[model samples]
Target chain A: MEFEVDEELLDIFVTEASDSLEQWEAISLNLKKNYSADDLNKLFKIAHSLKGTSKSMGFTQLGDFIHKVEDLIAWVIRQDREITASESQFLLTTHGIMKKWLTGLQLNGNTPDVSEVLWTIGEYLKGEIENLDQLNTSNNMQASEAHAATETSQRTGIEFLKVRSDRLDSLIQIIGELSIHQSIITHSLNNNDVQSNNFKLAVHQAAKMTKEIQNESLALRMTEVRGLFQRLERTANDVAESLQKFIEVTITGADQELDRSVVEAIQDPLVHIVRNLVDHGIENEEIRVAEGKSARGQIQFVAIADAGGILLKLCDDGKGLDSEKILEKARQKGLIKDGTELSENEIHKLIFLPEFSTSEQVTEISGRGIGMQVVKDTIAQIGGTINIVSKKGEGSEFHINLPASLNMIDAVVMELQGNKYSIPLQELVEIVDLNNSKLEDTEESHPLLNWRGSLVPLHYLSNELILNQDYAVQREEGSLPQAAMIIKSNDNLLGFGVDRIVGHQRIIVKSINGEHENNDTLKGATILGDGKPSLILSLSDLSDRLKSNHRMEAV
Target chain B: MSEAILQTSEQLENDKYLVFRVGTSYYGISLSEIVEVTEKLDTVPTPNTPDHVIGVVNLRGEVITVVDTRHLLGQEKSESHLNFVIVVNTDKGKVAALVDQMIDVRQINKEIIEESTSSIQSEANSHLLGIAKAEDRLIYILRFKDFIQEALSRLNGER
Candidate 1:
């Protein structure tokens, strides 16, 4: 039978299916921790909803497959039998199949072997039930997969809600347009001859209404990180079980709300961290027992909001990082000097270096230094910071801090090189007045200032960003500014020269539009309260610009 | 063609081609596809978009991505004294293409069908749906959806 589905409905269906699949993956990962019945219920609900929608949309193959997966999950929950390692992998594979089928359905196509696939999945479900009884009888301590399945079964059921991202995006865009219209109307009224008090009040009320609408629309797109964190538990379990070791995963602060985009971006890195904990961090159960520790290794994921950022802590109580070993590895690899005065933090940071690894044998999870470096780069791109703390034997904890919102931001306005630049207040430490004696620019010497005992590099934003050349020339033969702002990055601090401070303002950040080469330095653009356009400085780029300036001076 | 309602109203009885200019050539888009004419304003630029997409603009708060007519029609960009955004509602979505200036909307009879030239590919061949001769003026009709398809295809190739 033909289905009367509009293109919009089809688009929504595809988006919803994919979103559910992402959530399913998260839940599957969460199964590694003690299974809360809620996660399983949530997973079941998503599968059931997809089944109904796909069937209605005439995507019979996809619909049938989802039905089978949902049925098996329901049976497993009812039986209260622990899921085995192979069974967990089967569920993951089922998720992959569903994703593949959904892609075909999205393109208005059908998946072949739909029935055969469902039958195979059914066989796996039956096999899992049979294995459950055997697992219970054997009660093997080494059976970690069974342990994960058992834990997953005991948790309270969670019902999943399916929402199309396109709907959310369009809603957000519409809200944005409304705000823009309100701004335009306000601007037009200011220019009009009849400037009455009632007109001003009306405009003010409109602005306030639009702002509230925008906030509500944006809030609708946020989901808690619990779903994302849950997946890491399952991943750690799988890895530990594969290595024939006992590992227990714990989750803390699961109720922290994260933007949908952040939740999606953090998934891969979180998975990688879990893999590392299982592979390198967690010792074998025998070794762990011998050390007078619990036979099962423990990995904890904690989420919290600190200051203006969301902090995610992934800690594992296995074997913490060995700073001496890392230093030794660095020296052996000729990447660092032997006996160089490097702090624990500095040594730990080396793990993110390209091709830096202390592993003797490369595993499927990690050993190639590319993983952590990628995590570092990705986190930075999302305007997030990651700090690592590792003790020699206790464990390692990766603390990740991310901004609340990347699109709109509050910035501190400052004049640099006679041109205006807005700096994100998150990275700003403080502003200090530099006396004439403290500031010196020689003919051959670079603009490097010695602040305190450490040398604080001085960078001129005008020279670095070349704003003067791009816009109007800012050199008006005026006295040098006395106040220099000190900004801090992960480890280094730099002082920037600005003409004057223009106080703080909230700005609607417009992303730098184009596929230009200069995208690296320009974070985005923002319109000020008075309708003045300002460039929001990228802290990462600012640091790089400093290095480049020094390199140019050296040349 | 005979059974189809050729003329729905006396005003529309004359095969009037809604003539629009793309670069130097006078092109016509069927009146049925034409939604409205509005000034080019409030275009939100989409970053990393394909080349032909000038950007997206909110028309009554509806974000519609606009295509550059010159770029889509494979013509060179020229400075125009007056330009307007011709909003065309196509099957893909509502799009407003940049037009060099909207000329007069006049009447043209169906008898002016000229067999497309051999050397000069049919204007109908590249989203130019049909051509009609009205006195000395040749009105080039465009298929709105087909035009958008071709433009998107060209962009896909470039990317």
Candidate 2:
């Protein structure tokens, strides 16, 4: 038969193969307990399907291996042979091999060699049953005819369609443009005196329809966080095995709903945190026994929906961080004072500082001072905050708070140098209006505004101007002239001075691409409902400006 | 001595390098690898991105990061009036390096190229693939991808 390379075949092959592999993994896990005739039949049918799919896809070697696996499973079933430890291992290994080949097929349009793979599996199968008499002897006294009673269950589910990301993004962009067009039509009808009621009614319907279309298209890109959370369980298994520590990773709130973008952005940081738990948090079995604790460690991920956001917590029940060692390292690196008085959380937060390390030895995985900063930056970029909490002996917990979606963002709009900008509301502790205050540029060079009790570092938006023009004063005098936006992130509270306050509006963010003369300081541009382009201010860049000013003053 | 042709050897003539100026410095890129030079590129400004990356631009539809050659060549700034973005394909990936202006294509003898040797020299020297001397003027052949890496390292080193 001629092989067809179409989307439907690809989808069916991958889905069926993945399902079979997952079933095989689950069955292998139960090999030591018992093996039912039903399980054997299921395994045989999976192998049969794999053989058919692989042959049709022109993966001859893979097809041959599946055929061998089918025969082996059938032989075990008919002979009433009990599964040996080695036989279970062989089954699991075959499942892993199939997954690897599937991934290869996904990347390149063909499967690689599997001749040696089948030989290895065949050898492993032989170790379990040296002869046909050995297999029949281990049977649970059930007659050979009993195997004929069991049959394979049929598979049924809502299928998944893999759409390329660009196609989805393009569909979203067109929907965005459609919304803009609807807005333009509404404004034209309201302004121009075309007394035709039909025009007004038509524009109103267009506005409603466009809004629904935009929302639906955006929703199509979203996926549940449970799938990602489930994968983390497998990652924990691998990490614990490699570290030679018995760590059980349990996930709570896997069913919590989150946007696909939020999940994608959080994946790396979550992986890094889990790796840290396995590498550093969990003590060795010997150490655990000495500490009078259970030899097996426990790592848990708890996710819940907070007000307007999701709160994710990763916790480990093992040796907590050494605050004293962290402080010593911080002092040695000159990141903190020698005798700095800090809270337990503050001391733990010090670990996230750049170049801060308590580990004396470097490993291939982490502790190179790269992961934490990346984690912090990634969280900040996604309008999220990660708070660390720990006790000396008790394990650490990282609380990651993130917004629901980047596309649908809630921001506090403020004006700087007569230009309007929006800061994500997640970063704002509270908006404090500073009027007739003691905000001054200090002789020490860094501007500071004494707010209530604390000395809040002040950054003026006008100071960022290259030409140093006072657009704030140049604008008409009747409008609100100056204000400071109090924002908090990474435990640092600061105030940004601006000219006016524009009420928050839901904006569709359109990334400005190519090259820009002043792109460094600007984060991204948002297309307001009215079609005006507003530049988003980079808070980190603003902090850098403050740092540079401080350095200039010192010199 | 015979008058040497400005073009390189018979094997190298077809391999044209499109030369451009970022401020006062001149740099060349292979013509065959050039994607496209676009204007008013709506680049997503990345915060804390190295000085070389002016921003990321959308070419046709792909979001390609654009680097500033003025910053790559160790210059402070360039005229925003003549913002010319030149997209080049490097071994690492496709990067759109923004320049101030486009200069004419110049051929050089590939055999006469000298590899840069200075370590304690200007920051730009580290990114320069080699220097091609043509008559009175010299052109710095920069591996733009390597230029990005070297520039990022210098930025990190300064920090």
Score each candidate by Cα lDDT: 0.66, 0.64
Clashing pairs in 2: A512-B42, A512-B43, A512-B44, A513-B41, A513-B42, A513-B43, A513-B57, A514-B43, A514-B57, B52-B68
* DockQ score for model 1: 0.06
Residue ranges of candidate 1 with Cα displaced over 4 Å:
A1-93, A107-203, A367-369, A434-457, A468-470, A548-555, B1-159
For each predicted model, how many residue pairs clash, with residues at least 3 apart or on different chains?
16, 10
List each candidate's DockQ score. 0.06, 0.09
Lowest lDDT sum, 10 consecutive residues, model 1 chain B, at B115-124
Predictions: Cα RMSD each: 9.4, 10.4
Give candidate 2 regions above 4 Å deviation.
A1-45, A67-95, A106-117, A128-202, A284-295, A328-337, A354-370, A434-455, A465-481, A515-521, A548-555, B1-159
Residue-wise C-alpha lDDT for candidate 1, range A1-555, written one tens digit per residue: 245567667667766776777778777765644467777788889888988988888877677778887887897789887765555555565665665555444444554355555555566566633432232222222223322332232232222344557757766776666666566666667778237665666567667767766666666666777777766776676576556778777778898877776776767777777788888998988888898889888888898988766899998887889887888888888988766798889999998887776666888556534478888878877778888998888989999998766665678887765445677887678776666427556554346666675567676545455321322344667666656678886567888777788888766566532222234555666655544446667755667756776799889
The i-RMS of every model, in angstroms, reads 8.9, 8.1
Best by lDDT: 1
